[model samples]
Target: MMMNHCGLLTERKEAVPLKSIEVQLEVKDHVATVVSTLNYENKEDKPIEAVFVFPLPGDAAVCHFSAQIGQKHIVAEVKDKQQAKEEYDHALSSGQQAFLLEGSEEISDIFSLKVGSLPPGESASIGLEYVTELAVQADDGLRFCLPAVLNPRYQPQGSESPSVQVTSVPASLVPYSLSFSVQVSSPHAISKVESSCSLEPLQYLNTDQTQATVKLAAGHKFDRDIELLIYYKDAHQPTAVVEAGQASAKPGSLMGDPVVMVSLYPEFPQSVMSSHTSCGEFVFLIDRSGSMGCRMNQKRPQETRISSARDTLLLLLKSLPMGCYFNIYSFGSTFEHIFPKSMEYNEMTMEEALRKVEKMKDDLGGTDILQPLQHIYSQPCIPSHPRQLFVFTDGEVGNTKEVIDLVKKNSGSHRCFSFGIGEGASSALINGIAKEGGGHAQFITGTDRMQPKVMQSLKFALQPSVEDISVSWDLPKGVSATILSPPITTLFQGQRSLIYAQLTGKSSETTEGSVTVKFSFEGHPSKNQLHFSLKPAEDSGLTVHRLAARTVICSLELEWKPNGQQNEEIKKKVVELSVQSGVSSFFTAFIAINKDSPESVQGPLRCRIIPTPLYRAYIDSQVRQCSGKIYCPPSGPLIVL
Candidate 1:
């Protein structure tokens, strides 16, 4: 093995020769449309194939892809997954250049774009567009996260076949530069915009403060996920928007159907407001896998994943209510609990847990979170106290759908609050668990403060839940509505619920539409009603159709079952929807044009894997190479008192 100047054996290194990236986001109302353009140039004297693995929000609807090669611009079209892959392979085999972009079937949050056969010294510009709803943060602000971390995902042994394999490099070695800007528009006045990264001052384009623009400060590196928090003066107010269908498409289809987006943000009843005094059973599950041995932020090697998790866990331990029951479980390959059963949250128990947490390290084997989660769920629930399960992990699990299924199966026993420990945390795993378990998910990445987010989830877990949630729509005399989104299963205070509906038939010029969301809180039924004109909003584009298609596909795909017939049915629905909407899905992919031309210049090919943020284990191993002996740190046994 080769050793560096530090007298340490270096990890394997791959070359990713690339240039720059420009990202532009247009947020109208609460939906964000993102366009990212990558400029790839091969400095080598050979034709090269570059595979870039990137991150997108789990719920984003990717609608467009295009590439410009030597002044010739070509746009990609959606096709069946296997067919697209076949064509991409053929193009590459025929000594032609091709670009293939596709999302992971196992992990929706990760995407891979393969640009093959770039001639020497020539540059290819590839662009992609996606739309996603801005989730309301715990602090009452619209949150937009541009993922820059492509940390390696942990694939458990004996797991299902893998789909996409992610390769990562150190943050400093990620060879690409990123520049981003966002244009924000909403009916409500914009109050403020904030981010973890340094940002240029918000530029207001109108006197009423309804439109504004913001950009990342110059010199900011793409070391971590870019998060932007947008605050509106009246963030919780309900609003309705009706968008026109595509004029060139046939009527009655999703593309031709008039769609409406209803955002309902109802405040929880005063009786449900909770404080620390509220009693509950709190179970904390921490991941101590090898990956967790990595640093929480690449820029700061001292603040490791385990160390950060311990600090946050201690804060949570001290914040538990005096009379609540609590327990701690750490899992990697297997699992161990702090107590046989959840113990009372008294001074002695907390101190014991804190001490154990302090001594915790990434000594466990590969990450197998399912073993511990299944154990926790199988245990009987305590009487009178609601159970809230808190999971802290780096989101490296490969059995994501399986874990989420377990959460959903056992959801009746407890609510789950998930935390993604680092920038590369899988949004699919974290968000899916929370959604299935009827709770909330938070991400602690880069230099983000963890206290507020964890405390916020704690507050929500302690609060009373609303039941019997329902939505009712009233349309014009001839108009009928179909709900494109799945049924509402749970509701939390401060959480925003959005509904998308397609209107069929016709409405008179004076006709108005109304929607009412009803749920029972405390001991009575309450309703929130919004009335709006049926007239279509001008030139809203295909945002509504794409979003609606994404919603239905997501719903169908999630309806997995034990029966083979039912699974086949779901697969068919997903593909049908993806093809009809021209949007990417688990069963579909986007492939741009690539072919051999008479002017084609052929040469030897090179491969580059664009590195994402580096992992600490790889670094720590290098540190231990100081004298070819494994470094051991001294520590004391944990004591309750």
Candidate 2:
């Protein structure tokens, strides 16, 4: 009997916790290596698996070969443990077709598998090495999916069929599917459609404008370009989506370019779950550690980690709902409450909080985040309302597992979100805590334009629409979550770092689903939910992130120096997250030194620097003007640490 059991993901202001991820990217000799290390300690008794999956950007041709299980090897304990590996080896020798599906294409023969035992109280690694030839790039982005089935008739002891689901980007119109409600530029607008097989110019905005149509033949695809041609009396250049005079007759292939030209960020629901009320208690745990002094703002810009956090936090407070209770908690070696915890929202407290933030001094000490978090959780004056704790820091503590568990236990009645500031901040740890705490994680170095990321997070707090939205999967016999987590799992936006697990069994039904969410506000409880049912096949847009990561990885294979054409191309791809995956092309910040104690620096100091534009100011300030080869001052060597 296939018993269908589901874990309820409620939309409680104080529901389950979520954790985020920290992505580290390294580039050497035109090859970008992305390391996404998320540390999750299973509280359950039995052994389990963790899976991570993401979309693949660029064409399938870009990926050369792939190797799985580099550092840690994973094995399944069936009726016979050794027999599982033997059977897997047999499958590979038999030439069974294995490929990753992306949009409508397939990336074949990309992975080499290995099997090793993983006992309880231990960890295993599922490493993926795929060589790509495409010039793809991306930020801390990757598509992660957790499949259900792992072994045949050898189900995990405490595991359930896992379901995986992801929200597609808006404005993304997939052919042959139900199209979204679209408003064209004009009702009578002329439409030009082109594909690999044919080009059809529909009747000039005909009377039957109710629907637009374009047809493509079987086995034929095209890089389609849609344009609107306008005719005006006065002289005006016809604005076209592509280069002028270039017709949509034969659109060339989008090869050697970044596949993730566009990206779709998830829009979290705001309203609270039904049967719940917004409690006004909030604690802003600001990390004023010494690392916050690092300056990223160059020349025209003069900014540091502290200043950036201050500016963004002020904006967030400004958007706070009137009469909302809040407090500030700053941490270094010791915890200090900037303001007394209060339930009443008033100008006095707000002003006091703002002043405390401005006057907060930098303390050079090891980061012990749990101290301040525990303080907030232990407060006697705390109300029963939904509580929020925001942590901002630029470093990782020694004890990650202990701190995460503490946050999870204390967060039983509150939501915790983390903001990583400066280079030293542990993006993964911050994101993980937020995930386990059922909140979101964000990273703000000097590079990111503060408004967008900040506003996005605030919008979530102002009006939370859904609560406890958990994702799970159920795979057919043999397949299981590969990249990370085991079969049955839970996902939270901020707390959970995104990961994709690789599957090594026969491909069949790959089902993903999410629990309905509830929200309560204005003394009214509202109900809402979204679900998806996808089969494991070539057409399912499941492997978008995997493809994207492979694309960037492939792009890095070519030899490219700093400020060179290849370098610029990589930067462009990194910004476009949809077609790029992993940290293959994310630029790095390095320090260079040789023969110290030079009299003076000279020439255009050509050195490898971080990707962000904000760092240019520091480079210019230190490096003196000169021609040809330049030298670094003895004390002023180029450094990113």
Candidate 3:
């Protein structure tokens, strides 16, 4: 079951005031003892007398605690395990100044600490020490949870007074599950088991997942291996699932579109197919112009974009298959390769590549990408494997069409992916080039999440399912199609073939028919056939495998750019269709919004949250994506409505 972080929000009917209550913790470990101290604070000046509850991990058994307020400090220690009950009984007894309550403890079970009156402008702290033999076991991990009561202890005050507010602590920042583990029979068995480990509070900064330090013993490979699939839920709502994919998005979509994807494995079904093994050659066309200096780490410790690209290249070298080949080419006013040509993997080559990547720093001058793409295009030594060309720059080139045309010409043999660095870079031009090259385009938001997508793009480009796939659909009579997951043959190895499209003109009765898909692969038959049944599309849960196959040609044509007048007409149709379908677009929304005079809202009180209908729809989709572990942050913090 998915877990939710819960919160309580209270507002005064008359007075415009709010109160927040929170708890924080610090932990220390010495020898066999684990000491945990919690700090509780009431943000509002009003007195807060609510019970604060915390959870201890299942293994640890509480020994005693230290409590204090002003000059009253009390420490309780039990000489024997049986005598621990006395300490708790004494704490529950109220005192003149303050009182404490203790609960029973069990091996590795969660225990709660309750704090009663934390007055406004006043705070309290308490400490607990526990012992656990599990700490010495192989997986030395720790986790803790704390929950607060909002307005738990309240007198019948006027309704205008502020009530206590509580929020679920940020799970990623909270202390939980420090380690994870999985063990398989063999390296190959790793794929079969597809071990999954969960890490708590994965949302915090400075958190990292690493392979454990322990090594395989002499007789067998490491007894324990761990892979983490962290799921975090915000307390404000139910748990959700958020998916990530690298597909090109419809135009005008928010740059922060949530990617919805799932893991799969077809070949070697025994292996857990969370990730794909990929191979491709990386050709880095770097820009070293003077205007580009601001992009490099110039005087700062942070490496510039060019340096970042090089560093990313080094990381790719380390992560990609050992057989993958790569070449580095840098450009400014001129073009040059760090190596004479593409080189295969080896310790010496990696060292040389790393050194060269580091030295090819910021060289200020005009930016020109054509020269390098042309230079590489001119080379006869291009690797025979699936070729991937990565152009990294600030996107200030003179003639974008020239690059686009050049990319289109060579894309039959290579997929050219472009990266636009910095905020001012040209999105349209980079996107255009990628579309023409039959590759994907991505903007480097920042250096942090760069390598994951970059590597994925290369992998996708290299392992395309079927090249030049063609489709044609003709209904038996009065039939039409509304394309959904359009036909694209860049399918990965382990993922399923999820083809979706909408159909119109069918009766309430089922329709019978077949659709065809044709495509050619290198050294294969001139064409291959894929036939499927045509299902009548409905407004609800319609499966369009047939329509998807029929509309593959239209989806291909979606990439075509028309001449001046024709282009305008096509753009108009795209805008109209996109709006009517409720799909986002790069070209349509502007026309719709500008043509209408939107109604305005003016009042002392306004709806600050998104409409419940839309918010729930989006959240519902997210809940399905992350397998109930992720939660969509509610519109509480957004003022869309």
Candidate 4:
């Protein structure tokens, strides 16, 4: 069988259409830079346009995109999304070659790229570069993940926004090859690099132990997500990075200002840490939708998602602080509760919940989470013990913004700690709710230990978070700092708090810049100070400006909820911010058109599925005919909250 346009095997036993993928990643301190090249060829007899959807880390700042046909490389320029769309349509309808890269308006972590009109047997190479901050795990390891799987998200009936859809293809039918490597460097010495997947031994580049490199092993399949855990000699040291601004930008604008990112790991008072873990009304909400029956990973078939979820629930149930009130709720189309109200944590009640959890299956029908959340909010809050909500789910909701709004509204009464069970978890949902409601978010995937993040969230829930967090900067006269992000809100023990601010105007040559973050912890005031010279750091391709813009866009979107009176005004503000930053937002996308082709063309746009980055569960091809049937492929126990 011949290859199709998009890549998936369409006909009976067809060849995989995808060609090869090459990735290069470089990490400096806590920031990572990634460049990815994907080669695609059209083997069909007719010319066709290719549409491929892929996954990017939630916090990534995509800065560059280009398409190479033969020896010529065409770079893309950022523009207004609607305007870019018009240009792309006009060029394409007139038979011109156009490439468009658009971040999902609905989901932040998903991106769709369109390569226009490649004649039969023609090939094009696509290149992209992005920068993101590496998350420091609770175990003091810098975690970097290259997503490889994009699970099909399940939308509840009557969802306002149309859900983004994905098609699953068998791994055996996949026809592409992947090569990945990373170069790492930092001021502190690196102890070791770890991963669940195989990797080449570390290769040191410099005489000092600060720089090293690693690569994926030979004959490795592009199946699961590529995860690397980096351990540094000094894990918790506070560090600040000063990024240079764009030379072509206006001197006073955001792109022109040097941005500074500060990373800190707060040390809490031992007396307060012990005191805060004793009392709280803890609510655990679990998703029992049909999709929850899917396993956590493709490699391990016997570990169903529900079983792992049950295990996590058991562990959390046993760890609840004594004297604390707790309740268990599972929801699909409807919701089920173990007790009418939150019951105190005790041996009898805990045992009852555990037994119920053991017998629980993916019995609930649909992923309608709003009702359960509303019910929880309507219930009376128990006195003295603050309410802490824990949500576990493989996030697949279509009404993401609506859910986030609800959580934000009720945030005053409770803190939300969310866990995304497996790959394709909605970053917008998990991260948005946690940011709005004051709490933390954790994700458990294949080969991942849910204990570290789960225990960390419990620890944070028991302790009161740092309050009234504020950042202030001192610079030379005439030099001002515009904070790109909103103020700091939640600060958990052992977690890093990062801040980005644009340093505008000019500081005197002799003048030094400093920033201080102040907050009240354990009823005592605390402050962190960082001082640095005005000189710019090494050029990182304006990575900091893009990241700053991403931060601002997220902050603005979180604060800008569309309402009757301010709908158009808010949209206008977001568009303005997106265009100015040269960053694709919910309101903006990147599009480019090739004017070289002048002849009009006629052909169907062919789309074959390209697997998302991250290892995933095997897909079930047979569609279930009855509502009572649960079709689960062998996978790890995955349960989303």
Best by TM-score: 4
Candidate 2 lDDT, 39-144, residue by residue in tens: 2222223322222223222223221212122243222211121333344334333322111111111111111122111112333222222221111112222211
TM-scores, one per candidate: 0.89, 0.41, 0.40, 0.91
Local distance difference test scores for all models: 0.75, 0.35, 0.38, 0.73
Cα error, residue 358 of model 2, in Å, equals 1.4
The 10-residue segment of model 1 with minimum total lDDT is 632-641
lDDT of each residue in 410-505, candidate 4, tens digit only: 988989988877655676788778878889887777536778877888888888757878888888888778887777778877688888888877
TM-score of 1: 0.89
Q: In model 2, which runs have C-alpha deviations exceeding 4 angstroms?
A: 1-279, 297-301, 464-641
Candidate 1 per-residue lDDT, tens place, 1-641, comes to 12222211113432344567788999987899999888877776677777756677888899999998776888998887889899988887777888888877777776778888887777888888999998777777788888765545556666663523333334455456777899999999999999878999999999999999999999775455677889998888888888888787679987788888888877765654533248889999998877776666646767777788887788889898898999999987778888999999898988888888889988776678989998998888888888899999988766787788899888887899998887667788989899889889988764465778878888788776677888998887889889998888777766788899998899565579899989887656787889987888876888878998898887776776545568877878788778778778887898986553445547556665444434332422421211111110000000000
Of the candidates numbered 2 and 3, which has the greater lDDT value? 3
Q: lDDT value for candidate 4?
A: 0.73
- After TM-score superposition, what is the CA distance of residue 226 in candidate 2 from its true location, in Å? 32
lDDT of 3: 0.38
**lDDT ranking, high to low:** 1, 4, 3, 2
Please give the clash total of every predicted structure, in order: 0, 87, 29, 26
Q: What is the lDDT of residue 363 in candidate 4?
A: 69
Query: How would you encode candidate 3's per-residue C-alpha lDDT over 14-91 as one tens digit per residue?
Result: 111111111122221111233445444445544333332232322233444555444445553323222333433332
